[model samples]
Structure formats: structure tokens, C-alpha cells
Target: MSNCSFCQVIDETLRPGGIAIWLMKEAKEDIKYQVPFLLAVYLDENVYNGALNFNPWRWMEPENEEKRNRRTSPFYAPFGGGARFCPGAELARFYIALFFYYFETTYR
Candidate 1:
């Protein structure tokens, strides 16, 4: 789920301090920055417990379901966000569900 994000700084900005300053100490205006995704989905300790362990039952847990319904988990952006959100996200989900339903019934 790692992705590179590229954008130009619209205005000059200064960091308060303590963070590792990259390239310019201060973000200069109109500078196009190429930043790689620092967080890998599977490696993210904030989300999953262990990558090797498959725990589908975790989704059924009350607290986990609550977080999903609220959309508070930052690690779960599959269709992207904001104005660039995928227009067909809902359609894609519907198609997946339809396929699973047909496959289950036919196989059974």
C-alpha cells in the first residue's frame, strides 16, 4: 500500500524543530517535492499485530468494527481520499460482493 506523493509547496513553511530536515531546512515556495511512502501496510505496528498471523476473526471484534465504521483508521485508505477519491470505489465493492455471493451459492 506504499505510494509516492508529489506536490509543489504553495507557500514557504518552517519547521518548529526536532525533525530531520530534508533538502532545504525550510520548505521553499514552488518547490516540487518527491516523498516516498514511509509506512508499509504490513509493517505498520499501529495496525496489524503480526504479518505472518492471519486473523480474519479480528474484524468481527466489537472495537475493531467500531473503528472501521467510524473510518478513523488512517492505515485503511484503499480508494484514496479527498478530491482524488476513486469515483468507482462503491461500484468495485459491489462487484466483489456480487462475485462472492454467486461463487458461494454455485459452489455449494
Candidate 2:
């Protein structure tokens, strides 16, 4: 149940032979679909906090473009990635954050 797309590599439940699509660095310009791109790198310093902190501002700060890039950087894809990415991903994140906010504040 990890939120990282990189963690998907260590996930054992995905179907075998399943292929993920992505835009490669040097993909053929003529055929966009043919581009070979798929990845994850959540452990990077700028990507995640190494499970050390839960500062939502790392992602929610309006002036921090670098931190915001993490949203679409494939380092964290609670919804999904590539063309198959969920359109409601942001809404889903909002609900999840809401749930956590209430659960933490109320249950505490």
C-alpha cells in the first residue's frame, strides 16, 4: 500500500507481464506512444522526507515549485502515473488529507 510509484517495484501483487508506459528522454518524436518511459525515485532528497517528517508544507507551499514538482514527479503517485493516471487524483488526495486531518485531531 505504499504511495510511491518507485515502491511499485517492490510490490508483489501487480500482474506479471504488465507494462507501464512513459515518456522517455529520447523517445522517437514521430511516435509519442512508442516512447519508452516508466520510473520512480522516492528516496531522493528532494522527493520525499525519508519517512522522517510529515510536513505537508513540503507539498502544499504555494511558493515552492521544487517541492510542488514532487506531485507530478512520479516519486509520489497515490493515484497513478502516465496516461493512465487518475484524473481525480488531486480530489482523492484532498479527501485523504481531510480524513487524516479529522482522524488525527479528533482521535487525539
Candidate 3:
């Protein structure tokens, strides 16, 4: 995913809680809430070095790409994750790519 996509995922304040409401398994107290995964992880300094800053070049590093290949990588999901992954992920990416192509080619 591009840096724009990452930013969108991390900075979506409209969905302050998250994309979905989840209910936990049986416990002493019932808890239901939206787990804003990207936003939460993005705030953690230890996770992505200077995660607060927008550094597109970070994605180019071999270590970052390798982390992406791992299913457990916390920062890998631009379109959400697991069984509830977004259905429009591919279409969204295509549009973003198309826009980026034009922007990069046409910009001064």
C-alpha cells in the first residue's frame, strides 16, 4: 500500500472507534467496542520507528516489506484484516493507483 493509503487508514477520525462493533467471548463482564487497530498501532513509537511522521520511503526498506509478508505483522493491513477484511479493497487500491499515476506524471 502507498503512504496515502496508510495515512487514510490511520487518520480516519470519522470512524473514531473503528469499522465494526465486536463482541467478546464470555467473560465476567461483557465488553463491546470498536478496536481501532491502525490508529492504535500508529501511536506506538516502538512499532514503526518514527510512525507519527509521514515517511513514504520507509515502506521501501527490505525489513518493512519482509514484515508485510508475515501474517502476524501489525502494520500490514491497509484494508482491515482476517475474515472481515474489506470487500472493496482491490477496487480502492486500483483507484488510488490510477490517481497516483496521473498525479505523479502530471505534477510539476
Question: Which candidate number would show the highest TM-score if scored against the true structure?
Answer: 3
Question: Against the true structure, candidate 1 has what lDDT?
Answer: 0.38
lDDT of 2 at 14: 20
TM-score of 1: 0.51
**For each predicted model, how many residue pairs clash, with residues at least 3 apart or on different chains?**
0, 0, 0
Residues 1-67, candidate 3, lDDT per residue (tens digit)? Answer: 3445443433332122334333233457767655454666644666666766665555556766654
Spell out the clash pairs found in candidate 3. Answer: none
Most lDDT-accurate candidate:
3
Which has the better TM-score: candidate 1, or candidate 3? 3
RMSD in Å for all candidates: 14.3, 10.2, 6.4
Worst 10 residues of 2 by lDDT: 9-18
lDDT measured at residue 52 in model 2 versus the true structure, 0 to 100: 40
- TM-score list, all predictions: 0.51, 0.38, 0.57
Give the per-residue Cα lDDT of candidate 2 at 22: 44
**Candidate rank order under lDDT:** 3, 2, 1
lDDT of 1 by residue, 25-76 (tens): 3565767776534235423555545523444444444644432321234444
Report RMSD for candidate 1: 14.3
Q: Least lDDT summed over 10 consecutive residues: which range in candidate 1?
A: 6-15
lDDT of 1 at 64: 43
